[model samples]
Target: MGEGIGFEQPETVENKGIADELGRVLESVPPKENYPPDRELQRSILDQLPENLVEELHAHLIVVEGGKEAESSAEESKLRGELFERLATAQYGRAEAGTQDPRLAEELSQELVQLMHDPRRFGLEEQIGGIRNPDLAFFKINDQGKVEIEAAGEVKLGLLTPRAAHQIGGGFREGTRKMVEVVNRMEKPEDSGLLAVAQSRTRGGYLSASENLKVKLIVPADRNPEKVKSLVNRGIFPREDYVRLLELLKNKDEVEILKSAFSRQEVAAMADHLIGKIRERYK
Candidate 1:
């Protein structure tokens, strides 16, 4: 694991039942089918800007969003300096002559402002890559008192359908891969009491026939054994990654935390804020 990529024992969080109520609110705010910004408008504006300005902004955007390193050439730096001087003089002249707005300039300015803001409320902007966030995480303190991931799992929102199983399985792979790395970094490289967990809204019928169905399907197990096995063979199932599935409904404290983190009202309010920002920007 990278020095910066270790997990911390999360502070005990207040559980306000966000997960339990998310489904009800989802009916109204439905997970946005998609949330990309107006790419055409952005490109059109960039086309008119000085190459230096556009290049600088693009590089800045990459760094801000992904922490990637981008170094500007000396020529580009000189060009940007010259453009800034020219713009300063132009602005002074415009101020002296009384302000006037050109449609293209105004449009370009608005687009730049939006880009600078990098609105993320509804996932409007592209996110950083190579980071996988798991739903449930287990942590253990090493002898040095560093909190490390013991076990973790990726969770899907619905019952274990073939699709959901595929997603969860993929998540399990990613989560366990990281878990393996974190464990290797431990001072005492023994098995961490941590175990990966998989879950869904309900266990569903597919997992109902397991010998220890009640414990394995902690939240609820799926009933389709054949599909589950198929998904597992396809490397989409987390069965091998985790010791077993965990039902959030059975883990009282975890259920509360899940609910609090995914509450309907909280999600709605966040979405509403982003929508309002978009409307105001476009209006």
Candidate 2:
């Protein structure tokens, strides 16, 4: 819509079968009588997924069992986090047109067309922090085709609980500080930065009580949404001022990337698929 951003249609991805399979798996999930649902029941449902689907969806999955007390190991969590990071990168690259939900697909396509324009590139896990790394970064290509950093972003994925929400806030605070510190070390610091967080579909509730509190504590009153939509729909919420974060770390929390590109249905299927894989791996 501007100099760098353009409206170019992304090539259609042939993933109807994958989408249909994911849909079938989601539809098969019984209505949850409880918030987290029974662990055995959850495990059994995951066990029902076809082995091939588990393999195909592994890269898109984040397996977290036992609700508050998650059973996933550190290595497993690290692997899942990295896998989700890559998945988010690919989703941004493709603009998530492969999702089954038509409305969500259209929204993603439009956002992608608007956000990803010519002469810009998206990357994952750049070592922007001396001891830390932002999960995602955006680069600009000059006339000579050399890539230069336009912006940097951090990514966090977990259930949208109060604890997770607070963790996201703290993580972004520290990560953003690192980003600013590193950028300042350069001859010319980037004007702005992005802090992104995403939540899994294993648990449901948009802007849950804890999330609401965290949002109220961080997000500006005027900018905060009355009802926070799924992260799939709202991509990046940019803030112009970076110094505000450096100066007032607690008061002005500008989180740019807040949603996962994957819709609820897609995340559900992937979570189930990963649960199956994790069970086998740990057993």
Candidate 3:
């Protein structure tokens, strides 16, 4: 009911004395091919939930994510898009609940609480203009606390095949290009640098790479050349830009770009595991 569920500033959120408990529970999580096993990642996040937001957070992860057959499903994409847009309504968005899309706004209200808990680490919403908008845009605060856009993020909801997952990287390239173009247009071409985050829902575990790269591609979904080509032709990217995007995809490190794409069953398995953890702690 508050700006971020029960009303709190995103940056000032504290551990609520649950970090140690989570750390203990996390030890039981087995290591997987990806860093920070899926279950463990879920448990870690569980410890961060504020009391008021727990129920809503649980619904967001389970109910909303459950209704999708594929991560790219139309309904799922639309909801995710709404979440991204509402999240940018400013930290304590003044938008009255009555004036907005009730279901979508409610979900965003819940997710926003989690996101604000770590604004710097997660890009909430990056809207620049053109078809180049990122679901979440990462930022850095200047000395005066002014935010400067540093990176962009895209979120997908399904386990991808190796070929199908390359879409995320393509998304990254498109987002970075847009951010850079915006910076240049503002007459600060030196600020043309940007970072990208690729977030996806997978089955095996929560995997992340690029401890040493400018762009951060976190999800390991697969790719489909045909589908990828279709998306490109749809005008997500201009022809020339699409060509470069393809090169970026080919030159990208697979180990770094995508590890393995999973199935809906896998997505359900991971979410259920996480939801169970949340219930154990809060219910």
Candidate 4:
């Protein structure tokens, strides 16, 4: 099995101390009624955090909150899209076949595929047509230990409206068509191609449109199975056989996870890079 940046275990005593201190700092913030707390008050809280913790927390908050409300709606939308994309990548990256879905066994049994985020940033547009390229691409490790594109996924945030549903279904068709052509020309082509769509919420008018898209629709799992069944009945999702739910992290949960994922030294290194950005933005 291929290794990912999985969470580290056996937390060091020093790391535990840092987490405790950070937790206390976070808890000190006044309730939501007085939210967007006083600038000086926020700064004082930031001051208590180690430079690195401040940076990590700031970056995480941007992802979770989609930046300050004062920012342009377009910018906020972009940030929210980014958050969803990263969450989808993390969810699939750590997925266990049996735990997530027995249907995933075939994909998970092979040399694990690494899912790349925003492949276009790596200047892959020429290799994979710009429109056809997905927000996330699955590159499989072949028998010879060579990595090659195996599948693709698109992520959509916000309610799944009619337009969004059309985009999702159409994109799946186009992407699959493109992948079929590319794989056919490959020296060692796989038998099938896969495309997936991930959305923030399952509520919307997508059921009829997506009935025959041949794409896997991934949505965050509700804590109650009955809630998910309700969605299926409402036609927000297809039948039970077609539903694939992933548990995504909430803002607070993500904060806690980030605290445990980094070591003191790693945090310090990241902090150094983010210090200037944080200062300029927060000020």
Best by TM-score: 4
Q: Give the higher-TM-score candidate: 1 or 4.
A: 4
Comparison by TM-score, 1 against 3, better one? 3
Model 4: residue 159 alpha-carbon error in angstroms = 0.7
Residue-wise lDDT of candidate 4 within 1-283, one digit each (tens)?
Answer: 7888866444333245444544454445443431332334322323333334445545665655556532444433444444344445544433333332322323431222211222244333354454433444333332233323334444444334333344344554565455434433433222222222111001110111122333333342211222333223324544432243212112222111111121222223333333435456775
Model 3, poorest ten-residue lDDT window? Answer: 196-205
Candidate 3 TM-score to native: 0.34
Give me the displacement of residue 97 in model 1, in angstroms: 65
Report the Cα lDDT for candidate 1.
0.30
The digit string of per-residue lDDT tens for model 1 on 36-151 reads: 22334322322333423334444443455475433334323433333332222222111112112232222322222232233242232333123333333333322232323333
lDDT of 3 by residue, 1-283 (tens): 5575466555225544343444444444444443434544443444444434434544554555674323434434443333323223222222243332333332333332333233333332343433333344333322232223333343334333333334354544454454434333333211222221111111111112122223323332233333434323334445666676555545544213322233223333443444455558755
Task: Estimate every model's Cα lDDT from 0 to 1.
Answer: 0.30, 0.35, 0.36, 0.35
Model 1 weakest 10-residue run by lDDT: 198-207
| TM of each candidate vs. truth | 0.26, 0.36, 0.34, 0.37
Considering every candidate listed, which one attains the maximal lDDT? 3
Candidate 4 TM-score, C-alpha based: 0.37
